[model samples]
Target: DVVGLDGAWVNDFAKQGAIADLSALMTEHDYDDSQLASQVEVDGSTYMVPAVNFVYPLYTNDALLADAGVDAPPSNRTEFADAARAITEAGDAAGTAMPLSLETPSGVQNQVMSWLWASGGSMLKDGKPDLTNDGVTETIEYFDDLYQDGVFAPGAFTMKEQDMVEEFTNGRVGMMVDSLAHLTMIRESNPDLKFSISALPAEDGYDGKRGIPYASWGLGVSESSDHKEEAWKLFEFLMSEDANAELASMAKAFPGNVASVPDFVEDDELMSQAFDIYQAGYPANEFTGLPVAEDLMRQMNEQFQAMLEGDITVDDMLETTQESWSAEF
Candidate 1:
């Protein structure tokens, strides 16, 4: 059985004929795709079910905020920077903790792009890379300044998401943005850590609107599977409402089955906020699951890393990114 692959793998797998098209199985089994919040579709065919969807939110260490005399998390980009600086001073953030943890290359890429989207732009528009959008340019400049001002931890460009999570939970980061999947682990790692989750701050004049990147892991059957019928039976059974409810409860993730949602949603403040963000968010990138898209993303990341090291100016980075995109697409 083809299973437990990243959502981005769907398109390439289908192109290689390594995974069977799930459209017929979906219909034959009376599976309703619309009930799920995210679906993996390549061209006109369904390739994977939405097994577990994840979204990122700004996580604030409430204790750190209180120590910094910050009354609340910043609601806009202008205030976000100010808050970072204030926390840095009031809490001796440079020595005690990072005012913010912008995990590099990987998380930093998403962190910046979320800003781009919040500013009403996209990396891809109309089936092509559009990294030169004004919003995108502004986001890069914003981060360039933020990083130069020492808002993020030193050596952050060398840190990954896991590293940021470790710092945040260890009381070494005043704030960080990360996925819900990390929440349970964070709580378990440090139950006494006072933290709160909120949507990413938007640029001033953005009316508090922000964009979240959504991803999911779902099931797919291998084309070479001889026991296709039996494999599907297992897949279908797991996708059932009862099974989904159980799965959601265990994983602390949203279930694909609409009927199973309340099992994880009700009385859960974090999950409820997550659902709201999900309602307002978009897929991380439209180019995802496409062959050349990964290369494009890597090139973008490399440019971003260069910007962090003062090796590339923001304008130069964007110019290079656009050239790469133009060449690729």
Candidate 2:
């Protein structure tokens, strides 16, 4: 049986032998996945075919930045922090929106992890948990400083992703790191709201290619499927350049096939800008193929909230999170 799944859960299914490896089928059909945005592999065996990617880019309120006297989008962490603080101080809107709700803890993956990834930081070393590394340490410290400065939108600990989007759409926040898939919804929500999309700011002095976080819709076959050949036919069609392009266009997402460009890029300036950013950076989502990925994010989110509330030191938060993640590994 063929199945659609979140790219992140591919590994879990593969580990349990619940999903069939698509490598042999792909080879038999002469299907090339080299051009795809990401491949879900477990123990060097491909188990999932990515269909579309929803990339997370920085979204800034044009009027808010202008009112705060910020002439341009921040390129580095220092500038981003200063600009955020300035926006908060200049008006009622907070500098940035952060949704830290434990119920939907992927915020740690989409936002918190994106901050680290943007600057070439990694929470994994040798494909395992390494949350206490210098990069992660610095990232946590940076957010802690922002929390202390009160630059994050209110109710962060209780806010969900949709709430964060609503905050930005309503002019309650000056900036946010969100998915490009939301562009249409955002514009339709408030036709007069002026905004721009750009890459997430890197750390100061970091000059390497940035890491752009992404979520993907992936397809796979059931391990016990009787109609394996039929499923392969479906995969072949969907991954074809033309079909992939159409799907991405309908979803307003980046095509899974790198060679297939989306149609929206031509008519939408923001989409065009997002494409440029994607081309300049690498797709990054460390949790995509990990075991118990969502749980791991929730674990980190809890520690992060504790740290933000001053209930734990950064070191304590990191140490606690590291231990928790290692247990799963």
Candidate 3:
């Protein structure tokens, strides 16, 4: 039902008061959600709903897993590494390529943050920067290790976005992480490939808070909409179990309403596997007072890129990062 670039048509209708309600990600939960903010409250009235529950996970090659003699499914870091190492060996023996790939700067950073979150650290705390903490150190160090271990290609710093998918689909990479909706794309790429998803392996450091970054699209109704009642009705219908099931099929994503998609969930094995991780994966912005998250992401990506290129030292990143956070605070 949504058809314009950047979902602009919906926003237009919202602004015009022509559309009284909208199904958007902006207003799905009550104010109790620590990670989400309300966008529809005006003059003591509410006008939006948000429906997002799944984040992208990496898809792994089953044949590679079998060939490596690794465990069937990894539950923790030890198992994940053992599997990765085995895949590398198997690829080497078969004269194939690496088993992991993703070129997005933010994607890499998000993965790194999950390691940090799993290790119990975050970019901001109470509107302040917390990048110099121990968890961040280990996370970045781990990434550096992966980069240096030949696990990543020599030019990871220069790779393009879709290239990662191409690498995986071409069988040059055994694992690639993207949107949860990628299952459809993956199926289209290799109809018969033995692939499955697993929750991110847990960390060994600290308590391992079990965290992962979340990326989602959502629905929202406009406060200015004239069809508020109709919009609400449509919103409820779209989120209904049956409608959500259909949506899951069309969008290749989990339905926004958690309890309503039982049948769809029961029928989808990969979604089931990914949902287990979704349960443990909390938002990166757990610290309520954390400074503006997007700003920090942009800044950190720039610094991290320099650090990876050997143009900046970890200490330099630390200094700048702390300073940046301090200014923001």
Candidate 4:
């Protein structure tokens, strides 16, 4: 049978032998996977094929920025913090939105960890937990400072991604780091909203390429499926250059096939901007393909919330999260 799943869960499925390896099938069918952005491989065996990748970019409310006297979108962390503070002080809206709810802790991956990624920082080093690294430490301090200074929108600890998106659409927040897939929904919900999408702000003086976080719609074949060849046919068709491009365009995401370029950029200005941002960075999602990825994020979310509430220090949070993640590895 055909199996639909998130790219992040591919490794776990493969490890459990729940998914069939597609390497032989792909080779027999002459399928070229070289262009795909991500391949789900376990023990050198291909397990899943990512179809579309939704990249996260910074979304800014132009009117709020202008009201706060900010001249342009921030390119680095220092400027970003200044603009956020100005927006909050101007009483226009909260500087930015953060969804930190533990119930759906993927925000730890999409929102919080994105900051670390953008700055060329990583939670893992040499494929192991390294949460206490200088970069991770600094990143945590920066966000904790923002939360303390009231720069984040209300209910951050209780908010989900949908809630954050709703706040942005309703003009209650001035900025957010979010996926391009939500572009159409935001437009349809608030046709008059004026906003722009840009690359996530990098750490100061970090001139290297930023790491843009992404999620994917991925597919695989069940190990026990009787119709393996039939499933292979469907996968081949969907991943074809033309079909891949069409799928990405409809979903407002970057094509999983690197050679397949979506057409939405030509018709939508924001999407065009998003495309530029996507090209300037590399896809980064360290948690993807890791075992117990969601559980790790949940553990981080718990400690992060505690740190924000003054119940724990940054060091304490880092130590706790590091130990927890190390156990998984």
Q: What are the RMSDs of all candidates, in order?
A: 3.6, 1.4, 6.3, 1.9
Query: Lowest-lDDT window of 10 residues in candidate 4?
Result: 35-44
Assess each prediction's global lDDT (C-alpha) against the native. 0.70, 0.90, 0.53, 0.88
Candidate 3, residue 113: the lDDT equals: 64
Clashing pairs in 1: none
Residues 1-329 of candidate 4 have per-residue lDDT tens digits of 88888866877888888998888788887877787777766656788777888999999999999999998888899999999999999985899989999899989999889988998888876668899999989999999999999999989989999999999999989889988789889999999999988999999999888999998888889999999989888888788889999998887788877778899889878888887887778788888777788999999999999999999999999999999989987
lDDT of 2 by residue, 23-88 (tens): 878788777777777787776778887788899999999999999999988888999999999999
Leading candidate by TM-score: 2
Which pairs clash (backbone N, Cα, C closer than 3 Å) in model 2? Answer: none
Query: What ordering of candidates by TM-score runs from best to worst?
Result: 2, 4, 1, 3
Residue-level error in angstroms, candidate 4, position 142 = 1.3
Give lDDT: candidate 3, residue 258.
51
User: How badly does each model clash, as a count of residue pairs?
Assistant: 0, 0, 19, 0
lDDT score at residue 131, model 1, on the 0-100 scale: 72
Error of 2 at 81 (Å): 0.4
lDDT of 3 by residue, 1-329 (tens): 32111121333344455333322332542223232321222122322333543464656777777888865766556666666666776774221122122233454444456545554566655435677876676667665555555565434555554566566666666655555755667689878778777655656533544565444444555455555556556765665667766765566555455544434556677777676666555544232213344455556666776776678777787678778758854
Best by lDDT: 2
Better of 2 and 4 by lDDT: 2
